[model samples]
Target: MTSTRATVDHYERLAASHDHNWTHSGVFLDWMTSQIVSAASIGATDRVADVGSGTGLFARHIADQVHPAQPILCVDTSRPMLTQIPTSPEPQPVVAPAEEMAEWVTAGGGAGTAGELDVILLKESVHTR
Candidate 1:
């Protein structure tokens, strides 16, 4: 099993260059993002939480789908990696391991489980904790 500590440490080391290493051509990113957004049927009004939102590789692209006034919760364990995400399009960073994501969002994340977040995108960081 993959330890959560190991996963967080691994990502922490790669934080500085995470975006550069994962990013592809604009066309490719757009295409990929479109596929995910479409598959999820994300709408402008949907409350979205992007778990493991490393460098916002997908979060940034899905911004337009969620309302401009609202913010996408970018959850990641690595602070440096979250910092790498751009400010534009507006993402609120939540520093928490993937396993704790749900608790953070609903309990401490201030959104309240009122209706629950409409969408949660858990791309790439599904470690066995």
Candidate 2:
């Protein structure tokens, strides 16, 4: 497993350029994210958590499917990466490792029970950790 500190350091270094780099994903990202959201059965009442949320690109896209109050938890190891997430109504940014994602989810007013999360999304950010 990757050490949390190393993971954080690596993402911190990349945070500034993350959005630009992600632009290449473009239409593919849109299609992939749509499929994931549809398959996950995410709804307005469901509490969604985007693990390894990076700059919240996927989180924001997924948020569009849910209501503003549903909340999309943006969990990332690097604070810099979290900060790169554009200001949005649905994404609630949390600086934490993937293992601690549940804790952050509960703290954010989610159901806090196993299998209670509506969606736990991991884009290209998981392999780094």
Leading candidate by TM-score: 1
Flag regions of model 1 displaced more than 4 Å.
1-6, 64-67, 105-115, 126-128
lDDT of 1 by residue, 30-106 (tens): 88888988899988777788887878778888885445346777887778889988776567787776667766555
Candidate 1's TM-score reads 0.80
- Relative to the unseen true structure, what is the C-alpha lDDT of residue 51 in candidate 2, on a scale of 0 to 100? 84
Query: lDDT per residue, candidate 2, 34-106, as tens digits?
Result: 7877888877777677888888888887776556355688877778988987776658888777766665456
RMSD of 1: 3.0
Q: Give the TM-scores of the predictions, in the order they appear.
A: 0.80, 0.77
TM-score of 2: 0.77
